[model samples]
Target: MSRLVLLGLWLVCVLASAVAAIWMLIAVLSGSKRAWRLAVAHDPLANAAFGGNEDETISIRAGKAARAGER
Candidate 1:
């Protein structure tokens, strides 16, 4: 019974996410800055998905990696 409840909760989260994604898609298409900010969600993959510059992201990551090695 607990497993079934967990599955139901998971499904609810999935549906909510899907709805949010669709809303974001509409907002993004309309060029809403707020929507873009929410879409980024401070995630590299999210930024990349929304047309962030790949070269810049790569250079930033590389610089961080290099700095870490120096520490």
Candidate 2:
């Protein structure tokens, strides 16, 4: 019974997400240039969470922390 309920919840979530994605895609394709640009703009929080760069700084910091732990 519990498993069935969980499965139903998961299906509902998946369907909702699919609907939202399709809606966004339709909006993007049918909207104006400015509207499309607005939708494509990046979220500041997302950029921050991703560290905003695909560089070696993160690796450098990890290595430094590891070295400190060794001492």
Candidate 3:
């Protein structure tokens, strides 16, 4: 039916766009640029996730305890 054909076309378009977006993300991450560097280095969250600064400590305590409140 015409409706089935239209649905297939729409699905194809959505998949193509998703692939393009993923490629763009991969390209941006692989390149060595100032913006990406700053995004990874200067951003505290990113630094914390990737362990950027050697001097900085990230300690996590689980369960209910007084010492767990320090971090």
Cα error, residue 61 of model 3, in Å, equals 56
* Candidate 3 least-lDDT 10 residues: 57-66
Query: Model 3, 1-71: lDDT tens per residue?
Result: 69999999989968975775566567577773544644443344434556544434232212223365632
Against the reference, the lDDT scores of all candidates come to: 0.68, 0.59, 0.54
Candidate 1 structure quality by residue, lDDT tens digits, 1-71: 69999999989978987887887888888988767765655356444556655434544665776889941
**Per-candidate RMSD vs. true structure?**
7.9, 9.7, 12.6
Give candidate 3 regions above 4 Å deviation. 32-71
Best by lDDT: 1
CA lDDT, candidate 1, residue 22: 82
Ten-residue stretch with the least lDDT total in model 2? 38-47
The all-Cα superposition gives candidate 3 an RMSD in Å to the true structure of: 12.6
| Superposition-based RMSD of candidate 1 using all C-alpha atoms, in angstroms | 7.9
List residue ranges in candidate 2 displaced over 4 A. Answer: 32-71
Worst 10-residue lDDT window, candidate 1:
40-49
lDDT of 2 at 68: 94
Report how far residue 3 has shifted in candidate 3, in Å.
1.5
Better of 1 and 3 by lDDT: 1
